[model samples]
Target chain A: MQTLAAGPPPPVTPLVVIAIYLGLLLALALFSAKLFRGTSTDYFVASRSIGPFMLLMSVFGTTMTAFALVGSTGKAFQRGVGTYGLMASSSGLIHAACFFLIGIKLWAFGKRYGYVTQIQFFRDRYESNRLGYLLFPILVGLVIPYLLIGVLGAGKTIAGVTKGMFPETFAATGGSVPSWLTGLVICMVVLAYVFSGGSRAAAWANTFQTLVFMCMGLLAFYLISTKLGGLAKAIEAANGAHLVRTPSELEVASKAGTFTREVGVPSWMFLTYMFIPLSVGMFPHLFQHWLTARSAKSFRLTVIAHPLCIMIVWVPCVLIGLWATAAFAGGIEGTKPAALNKVIGGLPDANVGAVLSLMVKGLIGDPVVVGLVTAGILAAIMSSLDSQFLCLGTIFTNDIVLHRTGKNRFSDKQVVLIARSFVVAIVILTYLISLRGGNVFDLAVWSFSGFASLTPLVFAALYWRGATKMGAYASVVAAMGTWLYFFAQSGWGGEYTVFGGVMPVALSFGAGALAMLLVSALTPKPSQATIDKFFPKF
Target chain B: PQRLIVLLAIALAILHQDFWDSDALVFGFMPIGLFYHACYSLAAVCLWALTIKIAWPRHIEDWAEGG
Candidate 1:
């Protein structure tokens, strides 16, 4: 129920920081335009020329968005330690496992086929333009919701931090930058870079942002932990606050509700969690990365190194969430009852306010360092949002436009222009969606679950010759439909449900795979010539 | 083709859930830690093996061919 502080003067610094970053990003994009004059590949996939550290940075930056920083800490505020242990830790390890086993194979195939998008792989494997036709739309549909979550979260965070200082930083407008205007301007700058340079600019910017975010995050953690009496005192405070121990079955059921008697994670949801990694191949941004890897070796190395990056970035987030949970046990706003009543009629909208207060309080020892950490969070959100929207724009142009028109002859400049236009359109749509309000974390997870459901079929197409066009198509539709249906029913409470949790998503994947397997068995296979043409060494 | 691996990971993740949920176990140790380590090790081996099977030979050829 507590309200956030009124915004004004100190905020001008944050606005200045955002403008400088955007200007830099725009310059890079313009530079990328110079490179793009010669080839389409240079624009879209950076001619698959990324180095190891750059590849590592790009992957890291793209995945860890506002979800890992603010949203995660917020979740920790509500759920406690096991949320980190079960959800964050396990999911990361599982994702790493996928990287080792599946991601490497995709990289090899991407290299073999010179695939620009997941659609290319599907089209080749299935020998059906229909799959491409169906999947491009479905992938876009899935991306919209995910993009909504990421973009909205970024917008909201920017609005929160730089509430009334945009005019000062941007210097074009006479008045202060409204929250909406700030979000829109930031999105515009991101689009400018992404549209101009395509993946190359995103890659370089992401690398820079990733390094800065990591260093700042570590610095923030060091300051917070040392100031708050180190890990031992923090642990003692947390445990003393009864925030670290396992919740009772009743407690779990009451909070998670509808999933009773089951401890830890609800049993019914196990399959859903299982299917997510499969969706990796289907994520356009991730697929783009697959295409951008310089060689099979780079692809393999990138995937191998990704988990390490995920681990470092996420551990601090988990610790912060747990610490936030323990430190602010009255539920952030719950601690300030009088303020809550004055603000939102005793509601917990103050959770955001309270957590921010704690964060601000935690940084009392060093304001400059805190400012940098805040900048890092903004960078994380912007980096992920920019890459995702850029990739989504590319798919919209390449998959939907060029394919339907039956025209692959557009000049690189024209394609880039068209793609940038889509980026602008998508930003507007995302802003509208954000205004309607939804939990960014839940939306993000559902979006991932949606895309990931199709990952297994993509793998089959790339590696398994027995997979037919009909089967691959069936798998995609069925998996996507099943995922959409169950995920909607699961609600946004972040609890593992009996049916809708990870278990159902996994089942949907199985169902899709089975459909593909059976359908392929019944159908005529692609010719050996086609197979050799696409996957020669295999 | 990699669908099986995805499924196995999910299933093992479920087993991980079981380990965390339980107080008493068939063995003296916490099954969660045991399963977590076992899966991690097994996955590492598979990764190393796959790398060797496909990548190592290619590396050797590239080394020889480049020379």
Candidate 2:
């Protein structure tokens, strides 16, 4: 296994590089703030001024969070190459479908009616203020864990890469900056920009960060593969080490009594995993990003290019994770083999979140390269954080605050102030909760499953004019209730599947869709005015 | 064109379940299942670009942009 030198204190170059990267991001935020229009519309949705490339960047950036980079690498480290097929490729296809099918329609609705939050659209579509009230807390509850994933992931990556750099000063944490401190700093940095320029700043920062991470991801892929003796050699080594097995291979090996691991991702699980990516269809943050488009034409680039972007970022991370399994097959050097036996410590008990960082630090020679790659990972994490923070704040201000205390009561500046205050409050709250860390990948899957279950509501709203208020209410209640039941049954287990092989997302999504269809069929159709408003004839 | 794109997307989704290639490898290194999906993602890119050029909702653009 590859290893850094054992004796001397690790170089501080990576930390300095990361500090510089943060400074650059803060500077970019300040620059964006100078261009801020200082209106609630501008603050929440960039005043619908973003064009194609920036729109594509921000949308893709926000979607590709710690879950994609840190979480996928960790999952691949534990699960093998099937992890890529499980999420990345399916996400590439489904996320683009959502952008084309759901995103464009929602953007049109938002522009036509001056809507800034998803709850606002839901309330109007269902003609029920109570529906908005029901959705607000549920959406907020689901998003908190998503936000926690980013915060926890950023802290893990930063600490893992910078370990042993400050041996004397931080001896307690194995010479590493603590995860809590790192998380706090990350929360504050993301808050700075989102508070300053809101959605526009987030878009600008996401564009820059997306560029940084994609470039750095490719660099990390090349460097790590080279360090492990090239891509072919790395794959060959992983295959030989029994770390890269397909489901059929595992099945055959099991029959021959040569393999004992839990049958590499079952065919049923693999097929049902497709439902998880549909979560993008109902992502509140994505809805906000969609509303930022300058024209319907702005979506063309996003829809077309997003799949390719997923390919670029995900392929390298998955390959690196596969390689890490082989590279560390003999266990991490200088640590006991039994203690650090598996590459990422074995499934449910593993600190899988730090596998990518551990691989980067252990193999790469130059601290600067490590710093740049760490910054890249941090960029992906923070980019999503900014958008989620802004969206949550937008939802609070628009759905709850303004709805309760009439919109006319608050001036435009006051509305912005309310949003900013909520952003700060959520940032602090997420940071505090992040300290009680959980598995990044599992938390993300649970959060995404919750969102996926609600997609039936969005689909019905846009396509079926018969969808009524009661149907919408029933859909939300059924979906979330199913989600809670499955979540409780799973007991927060990482590889929790329903019916032995199927993902819980499939069950939740089905329950929601069935309720939406059945209830809508039994109820009165939506008013003609509402139908005409949402589905105008050309 | 829209129908074609929708049909193509559904076909692509079905093709995504590449259980047949699970045990095969390409170039003695890359798993065939993973490689197939990589190719599948690229195919999606092409199809989506075509959708934008041929089947994009022009009326929505016209309305939003005041064309």
Candidate 3:
């Protein structure tokens, strides 16, 4: 978006803006902690004090993340405009369905049984504490990659915004801020709020960040188009020679085109991407947030307003990515002075995640505006990271440590301490793993497949009378084993795709549902009493 | 009303079917297929708003505080 257009090296405005943003976040964390009652319930569920508007903002904020803003934009450059239909539209409808079908029921059960996590729900429903031995690792394992996406995304964005900050010292990064330092800074800022205020602070902070990213992102869109010469002119410049161009005949590739093997979306693959959103039905972070709702009425705003919020964030990101393809078609801006082209030219695939920031800096020619957009992108990312970190810590404390040893063995304060400690450990581990190279969007899709496969377990747990303990076990194994098989078969998904264009999640989803059905039928159903607990006669 | 909500979900999926997304534009600036979904997104929010008003399970809202 921002090419190295003729100008002084972009000022360190973004670095200053990011510093201001992080400082504000730390202050918010401190204030929320001050309001904390210092109870485990207070830490874990925010004492269930969140009202409707706050709940809606926090849930939508946590769900959006880098995937909605950065990943969608970057992926669009590679995949074309079909990226929007594949994700944003399906997500608009499917996510609300999950909130209704799973979230509300879980909250009611949580209030009834004093449950705070998904593991607690399953373990009690199946009458098996040993389920955690199988579940905790799988749940935590799946979530870490998703967490890495947020951290890695924030790092890449900051690196772009502050390109000249360490130009002399970091020769390879073109003096851009390095990702590792960026990652550490974000981890620390998120940890500050989550460690002290826990779920409540995450909710309050997410509400604020969600508003910031949305408003600032739209502003970036307006200013970027104006800088390129209004919306219509900008679109014409990018589209006439780039993505919006329709080929005469035959699905052929061009030097400017992002697609390699195919020119347009495959029919079957387009159909199956819908399954991807089903993963939210089982997301542990979402589960934790659902429990923090003050009442089932609180879910109303989230279910109704989520789609509009998604549209506001995604439309600009996707369009910007598409335009980048047209703008950087030659791959090097030889005619445009090197200083002006420095932000965009010469990077392979044009670095999709950083497009919006580059567009701001290169076009608007204002440091403060670029910095504001960088903060917005980081806001989209960090909002999700805090919730995931807090959820993992909660699962460790509630499911593994307390379930195995004894719930009463420790005081409430001690339990809260254990959760915070685990969150810190997980953050460090994820940040290290993110240092290795990968496409943020592809890696995210791989991670989503794992959770998508596990959705059947929750669906059956909530609604099916025929689901049994052995059946749940079989479903988990079948889904995960299929995921691992496909993940490895593709050589870690570098050239991954099923025999047809179908996504791997569809196959695993079928296997999981079948396993639950057949195993429950053969290996005896749970007593009607157990069923009665989950399926009460209301 | 509940049936209408279920129908809306089906329509949402079908509306995004993407069978013929290429070779067209809308408003002289957007692809016809992508443009269709952009409007679909707005409609989804409206549909869900109505569902919340008419079809959401009101009994669930009656959660006993100490349950």
Candidate 4:
């Protein structure tokens, strides 16, 4: 009697598009895995045969993440346009400098020593295998939270897209897809590609995802602006009301411990935030990606193109977040503009990234296109998660299992299996944590600070041959201590900073470098042979 | 490389000036600060390209490739 409804069953919804996207990802994984050579080398480092273009794609993809897409948008929503200068421009320059200094040198060393992980390089360069114990925990510990950023972003994005899709059973979360299911699904998809295709698959997936996100990001910007009565109108509207109210004569801090709406960003905090991007020079995932290079020349494209890529991806997302302040203020559907404040509440109440989704759904209303663009955002999030998951598995297998246990007993297959199992375990743990929820941008900034503080170690290792192992340990402790000090100063919410605006990284970076330089001077220098090995005559 | 690094550092300095953060929107559209960053990003691409062409240390770059 019903006759199956009307008109091609209304085509496919955004949820179906997402389902197709996931299915394609699995297919890509299985294909890559099938091509896998079944060697531990193949599984972990992709035989170090990746070329320049793919190298560019994978490295950029890994760097962007949900933080680049979701977190940047959200931060921009809270902080205003200064967010671009604070993160993107600084990242553009700092990341390239890092590639030239840290990435190229490490890749050369990795090739020479057949190094598979950062811990492996540190252990040998310092002539202290036990350093692995300290470094491994520190690196993996920092990374797990980074992984949570990706998983949490993915969950938020999916939940945003699927709003009202499950009204009957899932009315709890405004009928949107729940984060737990989204997190679990993302974890499984990333794990499959990583477990199957290994590093090559991750590299391949990253390339594809990066392309998707860039295109979809631009499209989303154009379409959303058009929906908001064009870019000029959108910006003009943003200059109005609570979105961009004229500054008050008196700048007062709110009960939430933040400056009132009228206060602009202080100059000192803006400068200090520059230190955060230096964290890239020390990211463990980046170290692994560097080792996958076919030659140092492969880095040429990455260095040159990376900033441009950052420009393309970041500018749009930042603008979109800023635009959302005005558009969301105007109201969604029949909702009155006057009711906006009560609806979204204050700065802390706004869901910046979620605003992106709501804008897409509201503005476009084309399910298929909305689905594709949402997939693009998801692509950016997952691309990084896969690389991170793979990197964590790698350090565990190479640094901990083989080096620490002194076990040559495991076969190549078993080594890959051990890595795969570790990846699965980490995925499950990250999924569970993501269900509890978090502010993706805030979590990412803290993780970046931790790694940024440790940057002195790598720079010292590469440039200063007299850097003794004891100094290495000292630098880690000092940096970690300062980091924790600042962390506790903020009551562990990663909120506080010195001088009101100066980021914690400013102090921690100084502490790390000073400790390394001073401790190395007092302690015994590394042997001349060791110096020759790493830092020989030009 | 040091000279190139200095040039890159200058690029960062030029872009980081808080002057851009003022209320000067580009053609009544893009924010001036963001517009400056867009230009800065392009300059970065050109600067790095020049660095690779002129300052690449071949010996150091090929150090581990047995070149």
True contacts kept of 4: 0.56
Off by over 4 Å in 2: A1-6, A240-245, A248-263, A327-349, A438-441, B21-29, B65-67
- CA shift at A34, candidate 3, in angstroms? 1.7
Candidate maximizing lDDT: 2
lDDT of 1 by residue, A241-303 (tens): 224324434222121233322223333443245455455656688767656766555645555
lDDT of 3 by residue, A1-538 (tens): 2435333556776678878988887888678788888999888889877888988888898888766666676666556677787789889888988998788889888988888899999998877777768988999988888898888787778776766666577768877878888888898889888998999999989988999899887887787666655555555544332343222112323336533333245677778888889988888998989999998888888888888888888888777666555544433222223343434433334355565555566567577887887788888898889999999999988898998789899999899889889988988888888888466545677888889899999999998888899999999999999989998887775435686688888898889999989998898788888887788733
Best by TM-score: 2
lDDT, residue A57, model 4: 94
Please, what is the TM-score per model? Answer: 0.79, 0.93, 0.91, 0.91
TM-score of chain B of 4: 0.62
Per residue, candidate 4 scores C-alpha lDDT tens digits across A1-538 of: 0011122222338889889888887787678778788898888889898999999999999998766766667666656676787788878888998998889888888887788888888988888977889888888888888888788777777776766667666879866778888888888888888988899999888888889889988988888777777778777656333222122222223235554442235677777887888898889888889888988889999999999999999998888777755533443332223333332323343344555565566567688878988898889989889999899889888888888666577988999999989888878878877778866545567788999999999999999988989999989999989988887777665445688668988999899999999999999988887887888432
Q: Please report, in order, the local distance difference test score of every candidate based on alpha carbons.
A: 0.59, 0.82, 0.77, 0.77
lDDT of 1 at A333: 26
By DockQ, is 1 or 4 better? Answer: 4
